[model samples]
Target chain A: MCSTCGCGGEDASTRVTLVDGPQPHEHPHPHDHTHDHATRTVLLEQDILAKNDLLAAANRHRLAERGITAINLMSSPGSGKTTLLERTVTDLGDRRETLVIEGDQETWLDAERIRSTGRKVVQINTGAGCHLDAEMFGRGLTELAPPDGSLVFVENVGNLVCPALFDLGESARVVIISVTEGADKPAKYPYMFRTADLVLLNKVDLLPYVDFDVDLCLDLIRRLRPDVEMLAVSATRGDGLDAWQSWLADH
Target chain B: MHELAITESIVDAIVEKVGDGPVAAVRLEIGRLSGVVTDSIRFCFGLVAAGTGLDGARLDIDEPSGRAYCRDCRREFALDDPIMLCDCGSADLDILAGQELRIVSVEVR
Candidate 1:
């Protein structure tokens, strides 16, 4: 036994025998016991937008490598987004290479119109989707063959609500609101106005005919987004096109 | 809506964490001010998770209380009301809470 046990014996003295318990049983082979373990509750603390932000960062890196300036244009239906793009492409026709990525629920009419302007254009049909997401814009960029050192204008699907939540790796996001849509638009849809880098008050030529108030609209927009740059223009008549073009050129 | 895309991502995350284990339920903490519609998320979860490992998994949403801080009055209050205002009758406020959209935990076997 060991000196501590006071048995004066070898290793056998160190072992103690059970008094009344059953004999221990031996397993046939060693194996993992995790199969019968209780299910665990894993706490995953993560930001919901973390994955989307990662993809957006990757898109930004790729766009930067090509030296392409992408702008995401958003507005409600009949806000003259397509018309503004038409004017923009024409105004910047020779100064800088321009490409149009038209997003619509259905129809290639916008793309066709842009094509007639002698510019490379691609149309992405979102089907029933309300907005164009980053993945859609990424695929469109690949197919449109966005020229190196060129400006790419992505006209998002006509909607004020859903489009504000998407980040398409655009250098700038421009929100268009027609004068006929009323002056309370900025107040009613503050999210779009808040996220916009520039707000284009289109169809200004129709201000005299319609009941829209340009001053009130501008005031509301200013109240909501104080730092957001704004342009008052009519895409059809090309009124104030020089200012819009100058802003683009500066960027 | 875009909730389908969010659901797909959530399912992917679950699969990554739990592997091929049977997922019994997924619990999400969605706030009222998260900008995500809870009904749309629930509706899309079933559609996106079909045939995947998370198929038939129950979705449990926990809506936490929201709060806002008044800039003018310098007070904090609950955002349970439709209008975000302070007890001092100041409407100018900045949201302090209730913008959470997260998968806090998952029960898997």
Candidate 2:
């Protein structure tokens, strides 16, 4: 998590701590007497994430110059992003030199899983951070040194909100939602769906067991992003894999 | 949920702008479509502002209603929700305003 924004940090996750007794607190200095200091408002007109955006542009330029297509995968926790990536690399691995940059609060599990597919992988532990910033991606790209013309996939920390505002300099943005979660997922997280170029409805094979209304889901998604493309796929059963692959190939 | 982070940015930006002295107040122009909840930002600012020069400083937010450009209608209109169709019933649109996320200024004494 960014110390400046308090968004990205190992302890960024939601928590409520209970103190056994009263805790000491910082008080304003009485001798400061800074009051009566002429107050003047300075116009800044500066974006809060200006630094992140600048780094994102740099990452974009660097990747574009090398002819690399970077993809940012976003979703809530347990949306099966890693599963989709595993299948994606397994299927598209032969066609392109695939590289995976996995972002997690604290874990090498996703990276190890990607490595098991016999592909290049790097893991970024955000500690308490909820999203992957461009600075982290820049460092990841530099360290991984992906081969020319290769496909780089950044599996952002399982978050829909924070990551939605962050631009990782990816050529494409894909948001995934599992059928088991709910059909209203898109509507519930409009910002996430609104920014995505494509929404991957993952774990479709389990749709029969779950009451996820496909049409309703599509309808809600349409309201948020009328033109955004969607593909229903079962990463485990290999259903609808061809369409997803074709879409990627076209990109 | 991410308000803590934003409040931190607000404090950090004010600190950077003044460098020294006690801040009187901080003003931000938040876009309605920026996805930040004003209530949450306000709630977090108090805690994040403590102990810093900005402590006890007032936080003011200027929120501008979101507006979008409808490609099909070729018209610009206020947008409360991005999915809302234009007057022409076309969903094809590009957001224009309501995405503003910036600090307009800080009053330092």
Predicted complexes: DockQ each: 0.39, 0.49
lDDT of 2 by residue, A131-155 (tens): 8989899999988999889999999
Indicate the residue-level lDDT of A180 in model 2.
Answer: 89
lDDT of each: 0.78, 0.83
Runs of candidate 1 exceeding 4 Å displacement: A1-39, B64-96
**Interface RMSD, every prediction, one decimal place:** 3.7, 1.9
Best by DockQ: 2
Q: For every candidate, how close is chain A to the native chain A in TM-score?
A: 0.82, 0.85
Q: Which of the CAPRI classes, incorrect, acceptable, medium or high, describes model 2?
A: medium
Share of reference contacts kept by candidate 1: 0.41
Cα miss at B15, model 2 (Å)?
3.0
Output the TM-score of candidate 2: 0.85
lDDT of candidate 2 at residue A194, scale 0 to 100? 86
Q: Please, what are the lDDT tens digits per residue for candidate 1 over residues A83-168?
A: 78887888786888899899999999999999999999999999968888788888898899987899999999998877876788
Give candidate 2's whole-model lDDT. 0.83
Which candidate comes out best when scored by TM-score?
2
